[model samples]
Target: MVYAPIHESLPGPISPSDRIESIDALRGVALLGVLAINLVTEFRVSIFQHFLPAALPASSLDRAVETVLMLAVDMKAFALFSLLFGVGLAIQFEHLAANSRRALLLFRRLLVLLIFGLIHLCLIWNGDILTAYAIAGLVVLPFLFGPRWLLLAGAAAFLGLYLTMQVWSPPGLFPSLASIQSNVEEANRVYATGNFGEVLAFRLREIALILPLHIYVFPRTLGLFLLGAFVWRSGVLQKPNHVLLFTAGAGCVGLGAAMILLRAGNAMAGTSFGVLATPAGTILLALGYGAIIIAIASSARGNALLGWAAPLGRMAFTNYLAQSVIFGWIFYGYGLGLFGHLGAAEALAIGLVVYVAQVIFSGWWLGRHRYGPVEWLWRTLMYGTPQPLLRAGLNDSGQRAA
Candidate 1:
């Protein structure tokens, strides 16, 4: 079923010179979408409120915006990010010479990421995906060496478990308006007025809430990772073609549309159907988005425009942390204390503005440096040695010695 050139006979791992620009562009795009959804949380709004009618009253425009975002952005963005992480692991595994070496490196990488996630959750923000990705990375490690069918089966099993839980789980336990309002009020009070210690305590409580959902979220994340690995093993991304890209893009969009229609009659905010369909639709849409971005990046003019994202993508680790730091200052008590004051539309606008600025800053930094500051640190820590940071004479991929 693979539609690209096979790399079975390749001599060694793909060099940095062989980096995929489309993947980078897609990651950059996913980052923006992630920020879109995260803005709601950062603004101290209860995302559960979107599902519960009795929570804080939102403006009609806010509800409309939330609906649009739920349909298009929410889970889809994170799914894309998860897929990319798997693709990265696959690429790294391909490049390494030995399984032991690969495992060691990956373990180190994931461990570092876990630490970063903890820091982010405890100090910067409670919603950190890096920790989840790290956990999922561990969950997916066993399948990396297995056949493609085995990986697919594992993904299917995980997804099936999630669906089953959603179908049979009691909907009554879903967040009530009273509960949602209480949490929102507490979050606003702590985040907008509390000291650092108080903020940390509030974040820990939020993380505690997230822990129970890992039963579903972890498996979903692992499944997407395996799917990404499958894509890489199939050699689809390596040999991007117009026909394949179009078909993938169209098929995913079609599937997502169908799923959305299935749940159209129900209020999607907190219903079981919403739980199942939302992720399913978003997963399909995210695939379609990846395909479309690949198509665009394969073209000349489109590639030129999308290339802006490559630098941003390359520095994604740095930019992601930067976002937490910057947004924390803007919205939290220690800084501007603007929490609970902004609407969906206003928060989204701010996210876009910040993203654009990150893109520009990423480009400027990459032009002078081999890697983003945090990326350099990450590599250094993973390898237990100093990694080059300057790019005096290095090439675009920054793999060449300066």
Candidate 2:
């Protein structure tokens, strides 16, 4: 879901110490969660629906695991990631004082994102989020300069809109097939026999529909963005001493999880109330996520676990792309041809394996390199200069010191 291009150079000071490990760690966690959900997508339907079935064995244990993942990661990651994007935007604007130049910078960034998104959609997969994000980010650009209250108000409206849209969304958004054999046969053709052009056409069609109907995602994103801004403005992210923050987060996690559990049985119905409840639950879950990060940052201060997650967060874009590549290989006809073969439980197992590998790989790679491979490329493109890619131990550029 990473979009936008790097400017030849971003103006203003890029501070070394401005980094916050807590936020980075939380981002790392969110990235893994996103992967968990995406794994299911790659293994299941062309659209985000329940139209497909698991090719793997379906045991009660597996079903329970699938249910949990659907609850925790499916709706949660987008909210968390969107909030982070908003926070990042606020930070970026603060770095460069509001001006036509800043607007130009953001526009260029969006353009780059659009280009990358198109590539991802056409070549990698049709169910790309970068394109949607680029569109939404552009939609809210004018409001970026608006007052905090206005931003919050915009977010509230979007949240309501998203809730309403969920009401109408199809169960699992996948078409119900008359038989498993027919569905699998069709999926095989798309994944195995179909060419990129056909995939693009199908994808673009979905994107067109999603744009108007998914307007709600923007408001939800905006609201989280405003919340992040408020936190940043209030110094909560940096300070980490707000007891109320922890309390609110705990309340959100506790209450939100319970509410989700309560409503989950109805999730497959595509009913109005289910959609509203899911987003509502997601908001509370996001609060809990933020609070936990703040609390951990406060206590850990400079612990090793946070340090480990920090590198993953720093190279999140690289990691996210890597995930798409890996999942495609695993589930697409190009690899094991496991598409539509794994059950939800099996998909979760595969997701866990992928997540573990990424954590280890990210930790090890960061130890020797200045940046994750893609991150280095992005930075070089953004700065229009070659950036150091390897650490020089002590007294080096310190980019890899994390």
Candidate 3:
């Protein structure tokens, strides 16, 4: 849910002073789920094999963890992340002067994001979303100039189209289970034991194979982006009831599960119903989580309670990339090579540890610096100048000495 700004405008980067702490807190909260789900993908198992019969955990503990993740985290985290990406664009638009050239600035910003995404996708992580987001962001650029209703309608229409495709179960749109299984087998072997060059080559090959999937998921990601923008303009998120929204989200989750069960025991059901159901629940729960966090951030007392999360959210871009780097070291072949070794339970535990450390570090870093390291770099490149990186007591480029 979004609301009208209580403040004025800026051009390049959003200053720490201009931020809505509630949204920061929401991003922080969303990152936790995101990390959990990513860990499962990165450390425990490949998402390509998610529909395989072998995906069911062998142990009760891992099974329980998988169950919780399925209902709560999986698609929900990515959905929230995508929604926030859209929200950030809308906020940037609002911050511009009335006569501002929105397209050029947004283009530069997304170009930087696309570069970051490509590096992440090709050299660092195979499951990168930044490129997909930058691509979708580019597609939504023209809509920024449209009226509020158009944003909402585009969101609904795109999402409806995506859902229809899922339910329709178009042949060959989904990769065969055998093909996916072969890829997963090779991925596990390469990521767990191959050297740097070997892993890099394998990732390149995998990216080419998954290119079609990128197209398939675009509508869902774009719809969420548009929905986020609409809410920001309409102020629909300004005062939503947290409990009610969360309850509704939980119902959606249950509804999605029921949809999958309708075709349960069918081979590779994820290729069919699982894909159809997962995203519906994801969008709703993401909204619910956002509303809950916003409500907390709105109150003086509640804001104080969730204050720690604000810094975490503010540094989300940095932390997001950092997770890939750190976890790659822990799980990939060139480092600890623990890939495909941990159970769902252990991966979840490690994810929690990583998130806590990020929370603590983000608070400490933001106390002294104006932006996270990556964010500072992003702004510098986007605006074609060095942005300030320190506070009143520190002298830096773009700042006067205290």
Candidate 4:
């Protein structure tokens, strides 16, 4: 009897030519969801205090916008991003494992990513998720080759810690308005008028306060990575049977929506379960959204309609970092200083405009370049050799020239 590693036994990696470009499009969709939530939440206020009603707009339009964001996005967006990123990591490993010094290469890629994350968290925005993702990636490194059952079990065990925490209602783990009221007030004034040093200091303060929250969430993130890799090993993303996709999509939507609705009912009734209901609901809905996105993008008509986001997805890392830079300048004290100024509706509108610009720019840039600027940098560092960047390096078939 012979044993093969999970990746080797799986359907095997899809080649670039045979790649499902729609996955990139789906990533773009997830990115937009994240943008929508961030504009009204973190961009306007610190993630630490955004939960306070005093921190957000209170008008009817703002109310409506918040409702939509809460129901449709909020936690769902980042969940989807994590899942996609996990899949990307697994696929990359599959492609690299056959080559020389694969694990070392992955470590280099993650190290570079961690550096980028640290830069974003300290300099650009304190709400950065890249650092979390990079850390999660490091933890997930060995699990990429683990057995499929072990992957699922690891995800469950880690995620259960979060579920337990939410139900247990740990102090400081989940910030309350009372605890954050002063921080909110000080942050409002400081973030708007404070100098760069002042702003950095306040951000650092919040980082200390939020460290526990991050610690709690980190395990869930690591679990999601394993879940993503497990799903990738199943080969559903690249070579799906439509029936299975539809079944999973439909079931997930039904169950996830039910969980959310129950949570809402609990909120109305002032039950403790409402707050506890969010984590599982959001994760399930995100998974459902992923399945549906792949299903839609798999179709001919859906491809044409949704293809605009493909470039943005292809350049996800570049666009994500660029968004932090653009929005940070727009809202932070060092730039336009619009913190706590924009209404929720206006903030979301601005976010949409930025997203549109990204879509257009990504498409234009990819037409002439083989990789987005950051992707080029990442690959260059990963391989210790500068990878080709220009489309001119391509053969007539639009594939890279050997």
Candidate 5:
């Protein structure tokens, strides 16, 4: 059987009209969390070393900060983003009558995203998720029409394989102290003083490092995508299904507590179980976060405050790229040459300030425009035609106007 139209099967919250505000608010939250966790990489700090305080001789305050980040922000944000990506795909599918046309459109959209991602990776930042998402999107497209049971099974199987790899891998696989230090030094040297070519070379090396980990990461991402599609198809996000909401919220709290316990024990034992536990915990937490955000946005009082995030979410593509450009300028040699100078706390503070500015700017821009500049460009390329960037009036069809 073909996938049913979302509007028919889940006609409440997932309705096109009301969907944008809540989803955008949740996305905005995820963006902030991603920025917070990305500070370690931006500062050229070894994440492993930061977590294992003995490796780096971190201060108590630093360790405390890292603990908070690890337990809260790290994997959860990306999971939220991935889930949202799947929801978006399902939403698109709901509007298309012909599967062939839908597939073609999705392929073009992903192709445009891939091009943007490659540009960002090569010239801007190496920690690009867009490329990976685009790649995963292509893989996930065929499965969109699969039954919910099949999707759930696929998610479970892939997640199981990822966890098995994490648990079965020998501790000796961990990078040596010398290797970590050398890599850190090399990254700092290249990013702090290198020319454009040198920076590109370093980025290539970084991409190489990502290649090996994709074995686990790619499958995990696919699993999350399938799970997200399943969630959307099930109508949980479309309506106030208290049973699903309670289940997800309970799962999040339970998994979060378990993650904290695992981390504490790992810290004491000088081992890392986060590779396996963090993903599971974060997935649950991401679902819970999405459900809670939708619930809040549905309310009048909550909307007054959280509605601000919708604008940021609408411009997520633009803000995502802007973060890389602005942060690159702040840290890279070609700009401010401040690489490795700021500590985690300082970097986090700066990221927050930048995000706030983006919120204000995005709201102002969307007030007069149909889409963010980059988003407009992406849609133009995807659709093979120019789109209207200007909002005509309060009756404009774009969600920003609504």
Candidate 6:
């Protein structure tokens, strides 16, 4: 099946329209990848140090499993998600431009995203990227009308400055040794002895202060977004031929393998190159993911996996929130209290279980319902009208009356 942006292009071709199949498929794959990487972070466990590596020890068997997962699933998924977010912005901008209402509409959307992000951060988790993305998006807005070369140069400059900051620091920006130790000690205390409120409070303080990382990290995200826009313009998603699909698969495998090797080296040498390398690797792997999706779309093949994946992609915001809720129950003191207790492999196993359940649940829910719950709510807020929740032959906006 073909995928298109939710909103139609105004000035662009009206016949075929923009079918962004590659993005949908990529999004589905990325959602799963998100669970792969985020489960550890959300549970407050170090996937490498405390989970996978510790769980494995000297066993070649465990090492084998760890190697496969690290290469195939870790770190890359979130980058893909971020890139897609930028693509969504580009699509929205395209529509706004078509209607000559970009300034107000875009600002409204970003404000809403920031509000949603704040709620998620304060109530659910401190690692929310929504506000950061909204803020960065605003910074990138003026440059959106610039030429491709300028955009590329700007992205590169931003990335270079960010890398420099990582290795060296301005005075007073670096945390004091006492402060660093206190933060680490506090984290350990929360994990070891504190309750949910204490853990939330500790993390909230750190998150509130890390604005620079969000700003400087812009180059890569903006770069990827531009790449996505280029791809959208180039008809890659529409074509989905063997060459594109094959290239993507190979790319995913190659970059994914390299990242795994780098991670292993980082572990051996007590280095952090892996963290720095992850974004680039994620970009490559996202391409690979795109290829995989294109292959599925082009072949006209259907599977339970894709069927399930489609629903999650269709209702990504809801599913994202659902992940937090489900994982919170699995890991937090409010539920099973398995935080810091589960290893990476076991965590992945549980994630898979939850994924399967979500797939069935989402598929069933969509079959009978009009939109995923949150999607309906977001649309209602956007249009300032109460949208119907059930299907009744109305427009896609759910405005048809009984």
Quantify all predictions' global Cα lDDT against the true fold: 0.77, 0.67, 0.80, 0.80, 0.73, 0.62
Give per-candidate clash totals. Answer: 1, 8, 1, 0, 0, 1
Better of 1 and 6 by lDDT: 1
Q: Write the per-residue lDDT of candidate 1 for residues 131-220, one digit (tens) a residue.
A: 888888888987988998987888788777767666775465344557667777788688887777887888787765555555557778
Q: Name the TM-score of candidate 2.
A: 0.81
lDDT tens string, model 4, 41-101? 8888766555565533668999999887898788888888888888888888887877677
TM-scores of the candidates in the order shown: 0.88, 0.81, 0.88, 0.90, 0.86, 0.78
Superior by TM-score: candidate 2 or candidate 6: 2
Q: Assess candidate 5 and give its lDDT.
A: 0.73
Error of 1 at 325 (Å): 1.1
Index of the highest-TM-score prediction: 4
The true-versus-predicted C-alpha distance at residue 307 of model 1, in Å, is: 1.5
Model 5 residue 337 CA deviation in Å: 1.6
Assess the local accuracy of residue 67 in candidate 5 as a C-alpha lDDT between 0 and 100: 73
Write one digit per residue (lDDT tens) for candidate 3, span 146-263. 9999999999998998888777745777677788889999988998998889989988988866776777778999999999999788775555565765566557556655554443
Name model 3 segments beyond 4 Å from true: 1-10, 237-278, 393-402
Q: Best candidate, lDDT-wise?
A: 4
Question: What is the Cα-based lDDT of residue 29 in candidate 6?
Answer: 65
Between candidates 1 and 4, name the one with more favorable TM-score: 4
Candidate 5 global TM-score: 0.86
Give candidate 5 misplaced runs (Cα > 4 Å).
1-18, 43-59, 98-100, 169-179, 242-247, 267-275, 393-402
